[model samples]
Target chain A: MDLTLKIWRQASSKVKGQFVNYQVQNISAEASFLEMLDILNESLVAKGEEPVAFDHDCREGICGACSLYINGRPHGPDRGITTCQMHMRNFKHGETIIIEPWRAKPFPVIKDLMVDRSSFDEIIQAGGFVSVRTGGIPDANSIPIPRRNAELAMDAAACIGCGACVAACKNASAMLFVSAKVSQFALLPQGRIEAQERVQRMVAKMDELGFGNCTNTYACEAECPKEISVSNIARMNREFLSAKLISHKEF
Target chain B: MGKSLTYSSITKKIIMSLAGLFLISFLLVHLGINLLILFDNTYESFNTAAHFMATNPLIQTFQWVLFIGFIIHIIYGIIVQLQNWSARPVRYMKKGYSELSFFSKFMIHTGVVVFIFLIIHFANFFIVAKFGHVDEVTYKSGTYENLGAVVVETFKIGWYVAFYVVALLLLGFHLEHGIQSAFQSLGINHWRYTPVIKRIGTLLSILITLGFIAIPLVIYFS
Candidate 1:
């Protein structure tokens, strides 16, 4: 199939970027979105031109490394899949596809179709962990965990740390991302010890990094590659409120 | 930027929601009191209710508290709006606005219109009752200023009635989004009750809007 591509081009973080048009033809519908891009890059290299730069690790959806905003949605028009998992068949033949990086104040553009999501890392570093003793691994079934609780923890753990929530948010809010991290621990007994401190510190870090506040738009859940529920955000809110109310110390 | 408001965005929202909820209660009381005019055509009950509301010491202090609540609500709203606008400096090239709710997208827009209406409303009624004076007429029991008459005369003008009704409808829009959003912001959100809260919020907003609209309609037509 023939495709028209408008990809964002930027040489460096300090420079301004703009969309550049390119054309690719005779591509297989079975080829993945990244594979289509690979074909485009091969042609660019053959023409002695700089190929479009994007981030992708595992071709599977697990890595959460494929970050691209295709046709206004994160990871293209498809729901519940990252860029690497999207096949070219989703686009009609002769369609013009606009591809760009995630846009948010915290996730600044690194190059073409790539934005630095280290803000997510910083937020996680702030408190997305439990203070467990470093020793031999405890038996997995040692703790009496409810099935509902374990399922919720696993559900919240599905967050890919993708910045789609921020990019999709009007205010660039990181509430969805932060909330997922908070819920992953809050639902589990192992993480209950520092739950209060973890929520407070991580939320503090998220705010300090210039991420916008959540207005409950639910865009994060809509564009999520993992289809992570916004209910995690609700849970996080409950945790934050409880933590703020019970604690005496001020951040 | 006030250090005391708390640095956490959710806390700021929670505080603003407290003010919003306070103001919502004030709306109900005000609505109930004003509703007296619709039933008592002779204006006795309405005027007496107004007199009591004016002279009662408890209600008087609450009026001031209501004013403070309004101040806090308006100021916090502005602060959050400023912060939100500044958070994203560069706009998206192809913004998928459909990704956001209509309520979320135009909160500030409806809020600004409602704020302007509030200023006009105060100038029309509150300022006149406080600083200026309305003519009084002797009733069956005692001599009482006919505040309801004042309302009727004001609504007699077609344009004023139109403006009043439109503004109240805008207030309805603001309240619809605000009431539920406030709950979500305050962390009262849960799967079991959040949808219930949203529906109640919408119903309450519509009722309040119609309640305010009914007064002007009854005044003008009857």
Candidate 2:
């Protein structure tokens, strides 16, 4: 199968970019989308053109590195899937695919389709971890966690920091991402020790990074490759309110 | 006040809800007055009621209060938007999908559009009737024919009624998210009661928005 691709080409963060068209022939329907891109790159290299630069590591979708907004939808018109996991079979032969990097303000274009997602790293670094120190290898059964709470924590922990929520958001809000991180920690007993500080620091970092306010638009959840629940956002809100209330009283 | 400022996003949304609900109340009062036009002799009574509302000192005071509320609500909304805009100066570059609802994703867009529509509405209806040239019509009493006649004439223009209905539709879309989220933001969510409250909010939003739309259509066609 052959396909026409209009992929965004940007040399650097400062350079203005636009979609440049390329045609690839003999694409296998069974080939994964990234593999097709690989084929395109090989063709480009042979033709003495710069290979399109896109981010990918664990092509299995766990890394959340491959982010592409194909056509108008993110992750190429698929539900509950990452870009690397999307297959060429989704597109027909001779189809024109419009590929662009995530259009959120926080994730600036580094080159081609790759974007600087380090803002997510900074948000996580702000307070994504529990302050509890590891002394000795503690018994897992020592801490009693409610089954429901454990499950909820695990669900919140499922967020891969893909920034899809930000991309999918019309206002480009990162509340869903920040909330998931906050809720994951807030739900656990170990996380409770630093809950107040964690939420405060992380939320402040999120605000400082310039993510939009969450208006309860679940676009983030919908576009999340991990299928993170919007309920995490609710939980985060509850936690933030409680944290602020408690901290104020003490001060 | 410091704590309130810290939670300004939630506080601002609460202010939006208060203003929105107040506007909803005003709508009910306006609807009651308009319903009187259905009766042949009650037109004068309706005019009397409207005249009193326009001229009464208390009502005038309340009207100023309403204006302030509107300004605060819209200004706060814009502030929130600008804050979000500055926060994410770039779009997301990741390619993936999740399960967010359509209404949730487009709330801001719908809200901004509705805000523009509102400005047009106020300029046409509120500004024109209050300050523009309006003829006095005498029936059972001397009432300015300005308000009702202006509304009727505006609806007579096909584009005016069309814009109004479109604006009402946007309002409906805005309420779809605003009503339920307002409760959530206020921490009113209880396991059993949240669903019930959400349903009521949806129903009220639909009815009020549709009712407002219906008025223009009825006036235009009738």
Candidate 3:
């Protein structure tokens, strides 16, 4: 199979860039999307040209590193799948694929398709952890959490910090991302200790990091590979308001 | 004060929602008066009401309050938008797409157009009635006249009617998203009733906006 590629190429964050086109010939339809790109890079290397640079670790899609916006949809046209999981069969022969990096203000480009998602990491570091110290692994049933609540916590914990929610948001808000983390912790027993402070600190950090406010658009949920619900956002809002009400001075 | 400032974004949205609901009430009242214009014999009665709205001290005070409300709402919206823009300073390179509902994405754009429309609407009707020339047509009772003729004449013009219809359409679109989201932002989502509440919100927004829009269209075509 043959494919026409229009990939964004930028030398450095300081320089302006544009789409550079390439043709990849003799590709297998069964190849994963990233594998097709790997073939393209191999060809480029053979011709003594600079290879296309993109982020990927576990090409199996769990690492949240293989971020790519294919055509206009995030992680390609499929729902609840990452770029690495996206298959080349999703494209047709002689198709012109327009690929670019995520276009949010917070996620800056590092090289050809890599972005600095450390802002997300910074937000996580702000308060995304439980304060409970590691002693002996506490008895599994030591803390009583309702089964439903535990399930919800696990669901919220499913967020992989992919920054896809940010790219999906029109306002570029990180509310969904922050809310998921907050909700996950707020739902569990160990997390209840610092729940109030955690939400306050995380929300503050989210705002401080320049993430946009949630407009309740639910677009983040729609484009999320994890299929995280917007209801988590609602829960976060309730928790934030409740926390703020309790300690007017703390937050 | 610090707490208020910290929660100012949500607070401002609350204020916007309150002011919007107030404006929606005013639309109902305006619609009632305009409906009177549909009856040629009752046109004078509608004019009499308009005169009261224009000149009565109580109504004048209310008008001032409404003006303040509008200013606050608009300024707050601008502030929220600016803060949002500053938060995300970098653009994404991956060109990811969102599955955002149509009304959500277009709120700001629709809001801007509606704001412009309000300016023109006030200039035409409110300002004109207060400060511009009023050629009153004598009532059937043969006593006197008011500004009903001016309103009818203005609506008769193709451009005025067109502009008004377009503006009202924008308002309808704005309300469709604004009403339900307002409730959600205020934490009104309950398991059994939230969907129903959202539906009601959608209906009210559509009905009120269409009601306002229908008035001018009816007068123009009739």
Per-residue C-alpha lDDT of model 2 across residues A34-144, encoded as one tens digit per residue: 999999999999999999999899999998888878876667777789999999889999999988887766788899989899999998898899775568878978999
The alpha-carbon lDDT assigned to residue A199 of candidate 1 equals 94
| Model 3 stretches astray by more than 4 angstroms | A133-137, B1-15, B48-62, B83-96, B131-147
For model 3 the TM-score comes to 0.89
TM-scores of the candidates, chain A only: 0.97, 0.96, 0.96
The lowest-lDDT stretch of 10 consecutive residues in candidate 3 chain B is B1-10
Report iRMS values in order. 1.7, 4.1, 2.8
Candidate No. with top DockQ: 1
Error of 3 at A6 (Å): 0.8
Q: Write the per-residue lDDT of candidate 3 for residues B86-134, one digit (tens) a residue.
A: 7656554444466566787777778898899889888988888878777
Candidate 2: where is the Cα deviation over 4 Å? Answer: A134-142, A249-251, B1-18, B44-65, B83-163, B184-198, B219-222
- What is the per-residue lDDT of model 2 for residues B52-108, given as tens digits with 9 covering 90 to 100? 888899999998888887776677677777776675564434333445444655566
Sort candidate 2 into its docking category.
Answer: acceptable
| lDDT by residue (tens digit), candidate 3, A52-147 | 889899987788898877887778878898888888888899999988777677788888888889999888898899876567888878888999
Clashes of each: 0, 27, 16
What is each candidate's DockQ, to 2 decimals? Answer: 0.57, 0.36, 0.47
Could you tell me how far off, in angstroms, the CA of residue A172 lies in candidate 3 after the best superposition?
1.5
TM-score of 2: 0.82
